[model samples]
Target: MGEIDTERQKLNCFRMRELGATVVPVKSGSRTLKDAVNEALRDWVTNIRTTHYIIGSAVGPHPFPDIVRDLQSVIGNEARAQMLNQTSGEFGHPTFTNGPGRLPDLVVACVGGGSNAIGMFNAFLEDKEVRIIGVEAGGEHGPWLPDGSDTDKHSATLTKGTVGVLHGSRTYLLQSPDGQIKETHSISAGLDYPGVGPQHASLKACGRVEYVFATDQQALDAMRTVSRKEGIVPALEPSHALHQTMEFAKSLPKDKIVLVNLCGRGDKDMLHVAKARGVVIDTDVKLNKTDFAQQ
Candidate 1:
């Protein structure tokens, strides 16, 4: 769901059709989700009698944004309720609260397309005291600035992007000097993106959400750490989020409660992991810089 690039969305649509679902192909904006959205709208106009376009992210038309937010609200709502129930039962009161049932002091989630982060942050948005942190992939390193410097090649869009349209919503985008959209790449395919959702941009601007990055190595380490320690193989995207937790754990109180969104399973990334480790799939070999330089 990262940035809703047209190619990936089209593939997803194809898969849906393969699964025996009725599918109407939409090819319109970036010819991705944005275009799909436009097509859905056209379908609604022409076949208003029977069409339902499922909005995926937190940004869109009024009812859509609101609907998505409400749907995602379940995450925070459930986490808070579960925390209350568990802590109250254990300590005769909720630890997050001074006494009986209470709320959490912090919330965190990994963001790519940002729906999960938005969902987790929504419940805590009203509580001025609760801190929300959104973790993103560190595409590359450069000078420090929340808005990012010209030297940055990273795609932590919420912290370093400009207002623009991508995937059907006005949002923060990673664009080239010519204003063309630049494709984003990452070891974690799920986090690869050139932009962030509009809602996340606004939240970052308003200081309600703090953005951070986890490098590829750090994410990989976290993936390994979780597998070794908890016997759980987390998706690489959420491993990026888990990396942040490990970073924070180093400085915070040992007992601090940290929750990570283990977004998806890791079955899809075996090939990627193998590739990253230099496990060659084909016998094709290329000469290195040293060989060329010597020649």
Candidate 2:
């Protein structure tokens, strides 16, 4: 899901490599997804004839974003149908069918290249009663970064970004006065973008959707909460949405329903989360004997 810099998936990485996957490790500019994209773009240009770039996000250009939204729209459609048909069965989970059984009061998803958010929000545009909230990855909050820069350390584009052209599209971006792309930070590699999809910017300007941010700490805390409460370790990206959903839930009554897109699981983020909590992983024997041990 994310945690690209953790280097903890040694066995899986080796397996992928043995399957002929080229693992070009990115080693610059925060060593996150943004830098990995830069490297990928650089490599794509080297041999355009033999390579076709299939982006993971919905932020690139006009038709590409539309294509992704169309494909991912299935997510919203399925969620809608599932919620509509949810009923309390003797053996299945209980369904709170006290009021209207169709559609939730609120829909929440994290914004990483705006794919999941756009996908979920597209189906609820006409439903005026349903609230759409997009959560951005809010990284470490402090006085600038380690380099003493004067920008936020989080990748909160719609909340902290302005209009600009980036990644072959005009949208909201985080940039310097010289128009240089500033580095973005997030515990989740999926959200390490300095820019967002243009449609999200339009949604923000038209006030059709509300955008918020959840810090790394908040997302991590939410991740643990869901893990313990629901027995699901969510990816850091969706953890942002989960964190915001908790905040939004506090204002509403207990009966009000909120649908959170738990997009990806946390199978890929254990090492990153462990490192964040001051635990070291020694799968590769990189640490001392007294430090970290592999089970």
Candidate 3:
């Protein structure tokens, strides 16, 4: 049903296994999100007759990003409607909570092939007063230069990559002149991708939106900060947005409203987070041998 490699994702694969789902493991590259995506596509080709491949990101073949964007637009629609609703409350308007916009002055989401970010931004695109931001994985460094003079260990595609075709879509991708996709890294498996959705590329190019990055450490720290302040544990991906949100919000008055999409739960990331912190989590919960067998 899915391809996973990180010990954290492996644990979830095991859980899905208990439900009798066929989960595959991708063992190449960084053994992270990118490898898993490749394995899943291979599996789809092998069982074309009986399988329907639904990818998680807003990337891949044309119409795929558009399709997923439509499906996920509910996130944006609801956020917009809710903001309007809040404005009708006791304060008589959101001005006391945010800036002059009927919608949020700023909306932020982490971009991994950009599904979540696009989903949260679609409804606000026409609202020029509402600014949207997409945050990319900063990997080892947020904005690493690729001139051979700086270390290359980040997935800040919009912030650092060049245009290239990838997964049937022309978008910003980390690639060489030979058109080979380069390896991407991110502590968040979800954001470990070299190519981003084409629409995200368009949005950035036309200046309809802004793109930024949060380093692995920055995301992790945001995860910890949100957990402590809001009692909510967020996945590493969207923690990038939170990191940016906290940074910007702190400089503004209490009246300003900044929305950060807390996209996923942190439950799937505990093992990885612990490992990153040099904490060894010794869990040997075994499952059937065939649970991880390729389909």
Candidate 4:
């Protein structure tokens, strides 16, 4: 099950259809990642004998987080090897000076459910000299409504959340005073989750990794910057990390290297990015309202 009205859902719907997979768009609750996870859990529970559930991020209970992280660690392993294998001055980036067998001065990645960041950081965890950072979504500033309610305008779980149990895991969560989970906001659908992985919570507790945040505007600006300077349109998820990377890189010396996990492609984000930039994308294909009606 996927959230309705998300670029991820829209893109995945087409891909899943092509791959002969049925698409179920969850329209209930907040109609977001949390609701979709709820629906998926419900479905899995009902079909326990026949269905196997696979979580998308490094979250969920017990072995699931460990399984996801171990699988995703290939990203860090490959990146580390690639960087070490490159000869001196082979990496075109001016920041990379002492090329072969040299470890990066810093490593960074965005943290939503924390899979990608954990995967990227795992290889460098033992390297005491390497600095690691995880960037979260600093959506909008939440203000109290006249009705005495609060609007949850951020998804910076590690940076702002309190200890809570979510999805069968003890982790940091965006919650109310009474311990109710709060709805979160982010321009990136992937980073809009209210709870982070338990591993991240543990890391934060031990101070192994430093968690920070990048505002929606910062991510949008970074996306634009990458497009203009690097000729690559980065997905909003990675754009958060890129924003932090840019700021951190500015403070480092020319010889210090920073590696950012630019994970997702920006194909699905073109329309969203254009809309955010106040530019309308004219498309011959139109989506009918009935197409998204609750099943």
Candidate 5:
């Protein structure tokens, strides 16, 4: 991961290390997702025989994206099965159905590299009645430009990027007219990227899936909403999806069901969220005798 994300996402990195994985922090360029991916690709090519590049998201070249989507498809498979198996008493009897009975009117997920969204959408792709939506991070920008000219303030690749090649894949990318990759921003560390997966580009081109963006403030608000109302603290990545899901749900009838993929937990994002919201956490505060005694 990049140096910035390595620090912001320290808990996950530490957990990976505890599980016997070597976490390499790339300290070059913008020190963000794009730079990290570039470094990983460089290392993989140099030590092809000794290293296996297991990409976490559904980005990169052909086979890798396919592999990731296939592996992560378990999410969609399980969701679809659970939704369709109302007869088996899972999810109980639904108030509405997809003609065939008990299917989501909408399937939504947050799209950084699009692994999770692709995984969830794969199972429902054949179901033409299912409306699939992918949400991207809008950063601090209130709304993204249609032509992708404003690249620095948002990671809304599918929403605002131009078609270009990045990380060995032809996809929508935040780049300059000279084809140089541009910097992207998002409150969510995981969704800060310049390019999306090739499959997502194809989906966008074919109009099979709808791609939208949620602003940083909207996502933060949604995170708090879900945390307080549903007792589920979602990671910043999935909060974008939840924000869009809430907006989309309002237009639907009472019987319709919208499914949003909560792909990560908020445990890894607590500090980042606090800092973004201007809440200072004094980690260096000296413990009093009472504090030690409570522990």
Candidate 6:
């Protein structure tokens, strides 16, 4: 799966259990997505005859990358067809008679593990004219800093990490001197990662795709903006996309057509956000830094 979120995984497990699915807790490593994936892989290897490994992201083993790309192409295909239909209706010209169709001028998506961006970009990969922008969380480190200037405090790995193997793919990773995975932190839990998808790394290397950083403040502000303007409380991940979109809109021509992925909802982050804002949760409980840290 994408950079696994332990917080989301707990909620997923609870929901699965409620649906009568047997949930096996994987207790190893950091007891996070990486560990859970390793445990699942072991189980799949031992029970290949009966077990299924539900791979996430488009960068897994051979068939998985192709399979996921094909599956994700539907989003682009449908979107293309829909946009064509809308354009034809608006311009009063049938699709075929209107000559070659115009591709979307711009496509934007937030990249956590990069599945959605891959899926969306796959739709227009051959177009050669459309621009694809992937928004990544800037983490604690500010953007545009020179490489190696970043201390080990932030998790904006895509911009600062080295190429390596992570999760089931060869990608970019944040590692220590001995190559051990380093801990990462982000205000947006979804975009908090120690690595990026291999596809994204390759694209970045080739300059086929452009990556932008949306800081926590930008994402939080975008979240509030969308909530007020569109009445949509977007997930923190996609809020990053919105942040980029707003920036693009300001710089680009007005006629440019920009499509963005909203990704998921934001309900899961309320507690984390409330705590960050010092909203005084659990008023009956009080503790010093040592006790708080222990908890």
The lDDT per prediction is: 0.67, 0.80, 0.82, 0.84, 0.89, 0.71
- Scored against the true structure, residue 150 in model 2 reaches a CA lDDT of 55
| Per-residue lDDT value at 14 in model 4 | 73
Of the candidates numbered 2 and 6, which has the greater lDDT value? 2
TM-score of each: 0.71, 0.83, 0.86, 0.87, 0.89, 0.79
Q: What is the lDDT of residue 230 in candidate 5?
A: 97
What TM-score does structure 6 among the candidates reach? 0.79
* Model 6, CA-based lDDT: 0.71
Q: Which residue pairs collide in model 5, if any?
A: none
Ten-residue segment with the worst summed lDDT in candidate 1? 90-99
Error of 2 at 22 (Å): 1.9
Residues 95-198 of candidate 4: C-alpha lDDT, one tens digit per residue = 43344568899999999999999999998899999999999998864223347565578898998799999888999999997999998888888898999999
- Greater-lDDT candidate between 1 and 4: 4
The per-residue C-alpha lDDT of model 4 at residue 18 equals 91
lDDT-wise, the better of 5 and 6 is 5
Ranking, TM-score, top scorer first: 5, 4, 3, 2, 6, 1
Task: Name the better of 2 and 6 by TM-score.
Answer: 2
Residue clash pairs of candidate 3: 1-22, 97-255
| Best model per TM-score | 5
lDDT of 1 at 222: 89
TM-score of 4: 0.87
**Which stretch of 10 consecutive residues in model 5 shows the poorest summed lDDT?**
90-99
Off by over 4 Å in 2: 1-20, 28-30, 86-100, 142-151, 285-295
Q: Candidate 3: where are CA atoms >4 Å away?
A: 1-4, 86-101, 145-148, 285-295
Summarize candidate 5's per-residue lDDT along 236-278 as a digit string, tens digits: 9999999999999999998898888999999998888889889
